[model samples]
Target: MSERAYGEELMSEKILFVDDDINILQAYKRQLRKQFDLHTAQGPEEALKLIADHHNFAVVVSDFSMPGMNGVEFLSEVKKISPNSVRIMLTGFANATNAINAVNEGNIFRFLAKPCAPEQLALSLHASIDQYHLITAEKELLEKTLSGSIKVMSQILSLVNPVAFSSTSRIKSYIKHMVETLNLPGKWRYELAAMLCELGYVTLPPETTSKILANQPLSSNEQTLFDAHPTVSASMLDHIPRLEEVAEMVRRQQSNFSDYTLTEESILADPSTLGGCMLKVALDFDRLINTGMSLPKAIQSMSNRRGVYYPRLLQCMESLSKVDRSMEIRPIYMKDLTVGMIADEDILTVNHMLLIAKGQEVNLPMLERLRSFAKTTHIIEPCRMRIP
Candidate 1:
């Protein structure tokens, strides 16, 4: 096949046609089968079931006049279930008001009169498929570009202030576990925020960062700067594409749950603030652990703070701690090291200078550097990593 044909085939070829009338569905199958991979449903309910089973459909066409659910209503549900799928409304009794309502409320891509010719329908389907591809492509491109920029920024921060960034890898691990435990969507943003949360520390004096990481008491001025880091990080990330939500979460990471009068129910209702709560809990837990508190003691300390951390978040951490203890840690040579593996303990040079910290997730660059370093300076043989 040609490139364009192959691309189209790889993209979503499935188109769903929903109508109460059997004859109309049969006509659609006969007319659309050659140009499109078609699926027909008798009503909106059956169409929804199909959508649930196979979540990808390039376009969904529904007749406006149906027995129980109108075309507008069905399309609106489709928008929620699969927002990327293009929607079209077909009605025998077309009115200006109905068309406007369908377009506005249901987000319908096209409003077709019942006597839509095969040619017109085909053109509409082709346009809808093109639109679906366009939306998905734009989203994928934006995510890739933003993620790459963030990763570079994080590496720079790591090099500039190793102490501040040392704990960040651990913070990211915690955030990952919390997100997975809760089965939250859009985990990339949370993980990204965790990785870059300490970006603002790059501006702090090296000695100040050292003190903070060592859990030494900071002077009033130093404390103020430390507290302001979240806002600074948020400001730095705010202008990046698709990072608005992540920035907001970072800005509110230090906020106490009791600071706001809003109940958990209210906060959970708004996804933006809920993300902040997650960040807050993760940071607090990391701080407690960094202070040399035992896992149980850290959980107890956060619990004693009452409204400082969400109760469910604390419980998730406690559960994760138990699971983490059971995880097997094994030693491997530097030559065998690979990406996506977490370092079980700090990897240091012969003089004991920290090269990679415990709980740090290894990447390609770090792996390459370790391999190069191993040739001259003897690293403690058999570097340990958790097999997760």
Candidate 2:
């Protein structure tokens, strides 16, 4: 329920410059120092350390050819670590083909030739910072759009996968309790993450979605697809630009504690933020609780798993889940709409008489048409009257 005003942070008001060449790094640092917090990196490894250290960068201008990890590899890593930071590549010998490849592969911003002009670097940095601003601005816009989208999607998901939707919402409700119980981030990141986490289900078939709802174990392939759902959801939102970061946290939510994997490495996809840890914990609680496991059992299982999730979050989930579901969420309905009433929440502005017509997409247009039909039919309320 606690949603903060988003995007108070302007953009990459801070910049980090990376190159094996100390001179180049220092030169840019000197020129852009006043405008940006310029840091130097001798190599990709060093640059990553700087990212971990400062934990913030508006833009990164890195060399193409570096020991161990090249520019593309470096930015790919950066993308995992810092979803919002803009990246540009600096190269000397690479051809247009190579640069294009790097840009596509790395998801880079701009390219600067080797021994670049001072103005060019400044301009790129300026553009990158502006790009950061644009990026945040876009995410904010989508967040607004999706604010309503989540409520609608949750309702759709309820019909598609009722148990999953209810369970997920319960987990979210409990997570909210935990957050308030502990005074967690006084921001909307957790709420936003929870709202969009189930988005990947959009791509899931009703049958496949059913199995997950049935709370049955998935096949290896199904499990893999489920694991990759975060990326799928991220891809869907990535194009919108504004939901990039939320999409990111959503994508990595399944990085649960595995005996074979490291949560820090997997959950720490973005080293710049600790929300990954929070998300991992949230997912862990959902996985355990949705299995009908109790909080003590969940905690014990987690302990046995060697800290795949934060215990504090688990504690909160357990604590909240106990008193949580007591709140009966009142269902909002239009009077003309019956229990079996099927009105499009989309196309139709007004509620009208509509039955759940089979095979229809139930989108905006169909709903609009149904509303028009409702006024015409003028059926009595679906609620039966008491014995009189």
Candidate 3:
């Protein structure tokens, strides 16, 4: 492809070259600095330091033979830390085996023999840049296009079953805090799982969803249906491309911690399983709080459930309760309600019927519905709300 075909945007992506010899590194900079936004490091150590400091490096080229770390080892670290950056290895004839290992382990995009022509090296760099763009473009499509469509579907479902979706919003917040507390990776998957977790509630009758939101007892038949909702939700998500992992998390959300029994090392080995564990904790905690249990009491109750959750995940809840206690709760009139405020308690009618569930965020549709209800039925005014 022509240089112009790559576009100025793609051509501007940063490139890094690493060699143990400072002279070879300087020679690469002198030869190709004008053609690429190039940076050089004397060895693998300096290269890793640069990688840690910089956010956007489109290509990383390293010599195979280094003082401490070989090209394969360095590039393997790059794969873990900056998987999107295209990796290329340069090696002598004797180091060809290592170059091949780099391709297998480090996912190296291209490798060049030492003493290569400048033109051939430039061509390889251009190819790697094109490859980087392709990788990023696909990721953008998944994040923007696919996720956007899912969000639109979620909006529709929210309108249809606000009680279910509102509970989803509250659970999502808990999941977010847990993910942050644990310093988990692939947070977007957990977020999306939380967003879509309640989709199956849309299939139930409005009363069934209301009973669930109110934490009321369900008939055996209703309980059977309720237990199957995760399966239904997972089935829907499984059809979407690139969402298989998220689907698995949804499917396994109801799994008991005792059933899994993964060791600390094994718990992190499978991110989807960990994600499911987070969802279980969040969902049950939301249920407890909806039953009017205080944050501390709900966490205490969860701790009492011997096989329900991991102790560390339960500890995250304890820390989260500290944040919850610090938040200010105030009373607001129905007409004064606005979006983004969370309901501190269940909004109820004068006759003791639940109108809105606790922990539900105030949204435009909910606000309008409450207003219409007030015109016909008496609502408990000066309702309690929490400032997030």
Candidate 4:
């Protein structure tokens, strides 16, 4: 709660978007409102009223150059109340200065230019969501999951950014909805496919999490890098062949979203699978909500998303996220003890192991006398040696 920068991704809980222009509001809703759970306001007063209701919008984006309240002033006030919610400024050339001031004094995230492209807006909002998740996770780590190192890593990763952990949950929700809504072939492969689609992101830079979540169009260089992420992810699990099929699914989630034709023998989509479409759209929707599309707007946009996603899959997403949306808790704890757990400090553990590996024993004097007679791999897994 000390407000230091975090190195993980965090997707906030909800979003609120405000603007004076009805057209802008409507355009945003048209683009992404249905894709996310959204709350919208036409002006500062209405926005303030919504905030007063304690809706806890994780990310708030406002247009600059409003009638009475400018973007900076309105957001400045918002920062005071929901100090945790990420504030973003959307401004034209005239309001650029004010937006920068907001970024400085208000501790706002990056500012966007007026008439912001849907992709860019979505990316920024996703970043805000990521930040929120990180802070929440850190707090949870302090409160709960500090006991075991493995548990702490899990809680920190999941709580800080549900995007990583929620990949499984979100895909599970998608499968349940798709199986019921689309009435397609239900297979464990589909379920497995959904869960592991984003495993590639584990090795990705935290900055790239927002970019991927936002579904922002990637540049040529970025696209190439992203294209290789699947391969990178697969390498991590190569030691466990039980997960190879799942790795294949993750690698192809984005690759199969094409108009190109495929043969029946091909793994690519033929007529198009609702399950496949849902994952991408859901991923995008999650980003849009983070970007600041009010819940209603996000839902509306997802509903209105024509050829971008299957109608049946979108319907399921709408039903699942809007109604009976369950929030999972992040657990953590702390304790002192023992060896074999992941060491917190690398220098101490690594150097000691290295010295032993180089034929220098330093544990018990008896062990040194024994090792003086024989030399081999000193440190072994399930290291059973405590003394000579």
Candidate 5:
């Protein structure tokens, strides 16, 4: 593999080396450039930008001492930016304390001393790449294969109880936006949790699902059933391999801010807690809007409920709502409905039976179902929708 600067096309190596010293970077290029595909960055800031643009790297090697940010700090940032990338620290002054800190805080895969032979560095790089492959392959299996099966099951369940799963797609979108807006790492876990958050709804009767979705006051018995959904969902997820963390997030979705003393700064450091808080915010926001509350009013209502939501997450939702409201809402006939359009109001049949809930994203199956219904039953025309 040829030695190239950042922003070049990725080759088989997918390896990055960051150091403040040009001499050291050049030396790496001179010695190990042929053995592996090499990319170089002068400092941590540049390396981070490169990772942001390029998306992923199999392995990242950084010098321990540098201007502004040290190796541990840089590697920590790398963990956020490219989590699948295996990190290694190579420095001239490696102490026991530094090693311990690097392992704990930075979560580095390996530590190497300076003046290391090319053969040793190459071996380390090979191991790091192998680790990267393991991480990504397992994620692929879960996301593609396992997640696909679960979604199909949810879709079938949605058919049985449309009211329960009506908001699943919308809730997933909300969580995805928050993850990006808040710059939270390990987004897949939260997104997968969002997808399966309503799995337990399948266990509820249609009447109970309707009450929960409508934000109606449930009876004591119904409320008990409602409260157990998160646990039921979490239990099901817990049985799956590599889903322990996602299960925990679903398990804690209904937890309140008063339950813990996490500050805004500290909350960012804990993804599991943050994931659960995000789920709560998304779920509650959806319920409020479904009750005919405006964007600002829904956010304000959530904020008024002290100790119920994480303050910063609510703020993020408010900001996202402003952006979402920019889309133009237009009236369209049933035939004009296409995929990805957001429903502005509940769609009902001629008999006043609810057909599609508000805030649901239009999908192909829904379109086909609507078409099939139009042939047999009369659906109210001129649906109010937000078209992008």
Candidate 6:
């Protein structure tokens, strides 16, 4: 194959063409079949069904003069169904009103007049595919870079505010367990939100965090500051690319489900909001556990506050506690440290300085840092860590 043909083949080949006329659809298939993997639908309804069945179309080209739904309206729905797909409008009459609607309402990438040349249509389709690739590539890049930066920020917070960061780790573990038990989607976002949910505490006085976590009475001003941490954390993260959903989850993390009646079905309907509720429960449970309450007592205490937590969530916690109780801790040499392992106790040097805190989740960066520290100073062998 020629280089250009090879490139087109490698690009997004999936395309959808919607028109009420069978002849036009036939012509599209005849001309574009060799260059793209095409799907045709007689009308907007059929097009919607096709979209529902196959969700990964990279481009959707719709005829403007349809029976029930116009191309603009159909494309608007297409945007909701698959925002990354490039949209194009084909109309018999090229009017200013239709063109404006196509651009403004549908966010169409191209507006082509009917009876367009085969070559022109092919070019437009290729360009649309290119646009889709560009959009998805940028989105992937933004998500990865933003996620890494947040992870590093959380690691720094762990060092700076050990008390608050330690609580974050524990909550994160609980959320991981809960999400897995529920088999929910977007587990990464939930975990990330849990890790950084308490980031705002870095701005507050350490004493304030200590008092809040300990359930000690705080002065009016201190209580106000504590209440503002979620909003502060959200604001700090809102501008980072692709973190809007995570930021919103953090912003609502402190909400009480008691304010409104929400069933498991309703909460599960929106995973992001469900994540916020999960963070709330996990944080509260951790706070109770840290304040000298036993595991069973902590669960009982949160369970007693009926509307404060989603019942389904508390049930997941109960399940997690059983699994946690059955797990055993063992000593593993520092050289054998692996990611995802939790330190059962603090790893300290002969001089009694803290190396890694108890309950800190082992990760690559932590492992590398420990290895480097071992080079300069001595770390006791056979470190104790917990595993499930």
For all candidates in order, the CA lDDT equals 0.81, 0.61, 0.83, 0.56, 0.84, 0.82
RMSD of model 3 against the true structure: 5.5
lDDT of 1 at 261: 76
User: What digit string (tens of lDDT, one per residue) describes model 3 on residues 231-273?
Assistant: 9999999988889999999998899888886785578647788
Over 4 Å off, model 3: 1-82, 94-107, 116-134, 204-219, 304-307, 321-327, 333-335, 344-356, 364-383
lDDT of 6: 0.82
Query: Stretches of candidate 1 above 4 Å error?
Result: 1-83, 104-106, 115-130, 214-217, 259-269, 290-297, 315-354, 371-388
**Tens digits of lDDT, candidate 4, 258-297:** 4324432242232123334555666666656546576567
Cα deviation at 1, candidate 5, in Å, is: 10
TM-score of 5: 0.73
Model 6 agreement with the true structure over 1-388: per-residue lDDT tens digits: 7978767664546899999999999999998787788889999999998886566789999999999999999999999767888999999999999999999999999999988999999999878888888997987787677677878888776765555665666787899999888876457788889988988988789688768877789999998998999999999989976678888889989898875566667777576678788988998887776666777788899989877888888888887644332347889887778887777667877677666766577767778877887778888767888776
Top model by lDDT, which number?
A: 5
Candidate 6, run of 10 with poorest lDDT:
319-328
The full ranking of all candidates by lDDT, starting with the best, is 5, 3, 6, 1, 2, 4
Estimate, for each residue in 1-388, the C-alpha lDDT of model 2 and write its tens digit: 1222122232226677777878877778777676555667788998888776555687877888888888889998888767688999888876988688777778888977878888877777767877887987887776667766665766566555433344454445554665576654323556666766777776776566657654578888788877777778767767764456767667666664442244444433332133545566666655565566776776678767764665555566556545221223232233433232222222122343223322112334334544565567543233221110
What is the per-residue lDDT of model 1 for residues 234-353, given as tens digits with 9 covering 90 to 100?
Answer: 999899768889888888888888877788666754556767788888877776676668788888888999888877778889877543324578898898788867676778888997
- Give the C-alpha miss distance for residue 260 in model 5, angstroms: 2.2
Alpha carbon lDDT at 45, candidate 3: 88
Best by TM-score: 6
TM for every model, in the order presented, reads 0.72, 0.49, 0.72, 0.35, 0.73, 0.74
State the local distance difference test value for candidate 2: 0.61
Evaluation by TM-score, superior candidate among 5 and 6:
6
For candidate 1, the TM-score is 0.72
